[model samples]
Target: MDLIRRLFTAALVAGVLSGTAASVVQQATTVPLILEAEKYEVVTPPPATAAPTTTAPAASHAEGHQHGPVREVGEGVPVTLDEAMQRIGLTIAANLIAGVAYALLLAAAILLAGRPVDARRGLVWGMGGFVAVSLAPSFGLAPELPGMAGAELELRQLWWLSAAAGAGVGIAALAFARNRLVIAVAILAAALPHLIGAPHPESAEGAVPAELAARFVTASLGSAALFWAILGSVCGWLMSGVVEPAESRPALRVQPGAR
Candidate 1:
């Protein structure tokens, strides 16, 4: 019971701190690249019409600002400082929640393993999370910028989930399962997702420039990596501090009263 309480406490603390760190890293790296990608989306030329004009369509000032809403905000978002602040706050909150969720998963896994949890092992688990969630799915989907056209949302989501599940299960089996046959099954489970292939659009549309898209993908992946690292390290450190000593302490024996 004491261990469980400490586990929860550690997870909460780790989640909040790691999530804040992720947000800061995102703001510094990913956010700038996304903003740049948006610029390209704004500038993309409209597809040619079947009506077939001998001359190019006249570009207007409005064309330069393609978003149909406030120039300072996303389409349909109001241009208000308060709204912006609210959005920022919400994003940070979401990040914190995600951090907590991952931390909980890591904590549970460690407990199940019945092994000593420390910063190093926690970090390994964090890398597993990254591989399962980010790296695996990316092989198929890569990353996309706003306004980029791609596969149907449902199909893409399904594929991404499959990939994550496969990789995660495979990694777990490989690490934990003692039987060779079980490990082989795990390997197959992991490979199956990639073999099925990622869903693709009927046609690739490049609304954002290729270079910008590439940069954004790299930055996004980097941010995720950093987030996982911090979360794993913090949780591991805290959990170890609480659990290890308690586990190793010798049991106390009471002697007969000598009143």
Candidate 2:
């Protein structure tokens, strides 16, 4: 019994330590957002002119001054640092929320399975949740409507990348933990975003300029999927120790002449 207890404790400790290390590495390696500015031009109105009413005009009354409309001109679009920050913030927030949701779902699954709650099971549940939430949406079973063009387009643009990233991260986590549940979770989580699709574009009439929009969506989804998969795996592994097994029994031994 003591030996078993020690083994369980060691598993919990190792899992947690590994998870923490992975998280630190992830944060350290996160890609930073780069901002670039584009220029644009603004047209100004012409200056106002005043003319004398009389035919002679009183020999050209005192010279009058006229001011033309002030216009600001630039070559392309101009974006400020603040604008870039806001966009990055929105993207980060969205991914964080999605990740949290995935983790919660996994926890619920482990609980539902009636397994002895332990760090390992928690890790499994977490990975499982990531997979289910991320991958389940890809079945083309999602609802459809005529006016949802924008949303549809967004999904097409982002889902593939997201799914791929998620799968990679999931695989990494599984390998690190040596857990089947974790592996499964990684695969599913990586694939989930593509399955669900991103928010559609606003119009079918070229609102986002097809090619650019597609690339953006694909990159965004892929990055998000990978981020969440890694997050789920780490968190799950960290919490694995807390769960207890469902059944407990004493080791059996027989003595001479014992039936």
Clashes of each: 0, 37
Q: By lDDT, who's the top model here?
A: 1
Residue 18, candidate 2: C-alpha displacement in angstroms: 15
In order, the Cα lDDT scores of the candidates are 0.79, 0.45
Worst 10 residues of 1 by lDDT: 69-78
lDDT of 1 by residue, 59-143 (tens): 5455535643333323322238886578568879999999898888888877777667788878888888888998989998998
Cα-lDDT of candidate 1: 0.79
What are the clashing pairs of model 1? none
Clashes of 2: 37
Best model number under TM-score: 1
